[model samples]
Target: MEQKEKQILVSIISSIVILASYSLYVYHKFMAGNPGIINDFRFWGRAFLILIPVAIMAQIIIHIIFAIIHKIVTDEDLSTKNDERDKLIELKSIRISHWLFTLGFFLSMGSQAFGKPPWVMFITLICSGFIASIASEGAKIFFYRKGL
Candidate 1:
């Protein structure tokens, strides 16, 4: 596998781990104590706000760690340069991510319009974001493998 592929795989894995662990932590820390908290708009708002920074920081740290390990194992630096093909692939993947997130946003709003609980909408939104991220990375892998 190429270095870019390896990096993408690492990103995908780290994202999944970060999201799952953070979710469990939040559930146990807050929702587990009082299930009613799930219905609180403030709780959801705070959770979303906190999750953004936490995810960003965690991703940066995980990537940094991966870079260090990769260097140690391979004795070579990962390429940071992007050629035309790489840029094109990235653009395509980003388009996919954007559309998926847009759809998710609409679906979440639709759920609320249909009388679903706020928590349902929030969960839908979160799932959509996660799916979009995974799909984007998957697309990059596919494009790379297919020589796009």
Candidate 2:
């Protein structure tokens, strides 16, 4: 297979693995019966403050795994870095992300007409928009590289 095909396959596999791990983590958390939401400022502080580092670490690890896979599968040396095409693809991906985030934000706002707590709706919208942006970027990169 071509390098592009290999890269696309690796991207799909990596995405599936990361998503599955996240799903399992959520399931485990559910099974452990964590509180739905700690309304207390002290508990929320401790919980999300600790979680920020954990989330960053997880992203680092995922990037590392992608780097390793690219090194193994591609002819070019790993340190031989991103080219013009890569930058263009990334730029396009960011444009796509913007649209996705806007869509998610507006959709979430529309749902708030049902009269939920403003904070809850706002936070949910933010998180969903963030996820949608990431997913849109990924899809844009894959499609641009793989030509589909």
Best by TM-score: 1
| Model 1: per-residue Cα lDDT over 1-148, one tens digit each | 9999999999999999999999999999998869999899999999999999999999999999999999999999888999999999999999999999999999999999999989999999999999999999999999999977
Cα RMSD (Å) per model? 0.8, 4.7
Q: Which structure among the candidates has the greatest lDDT?
A: 1
Q: Please list the C-alpha lDDT of all candidates, in the order they appear.
A: 0.95, 0.59
For all predicted structures, in order, the TM-scores are 0.97, 0.56
Compared with the true structure, model 1 gives a TM-score of 0.97
Q: Which tens-of-lDDT digit does each residue in 24-77 have in candidate 2? A: 664476424655442344543554465456655766676667668777776454
* RMSD over all Cα atoms, model 1: 0.8
Candidate 1: global Cα-lDDT?
A: 0.95
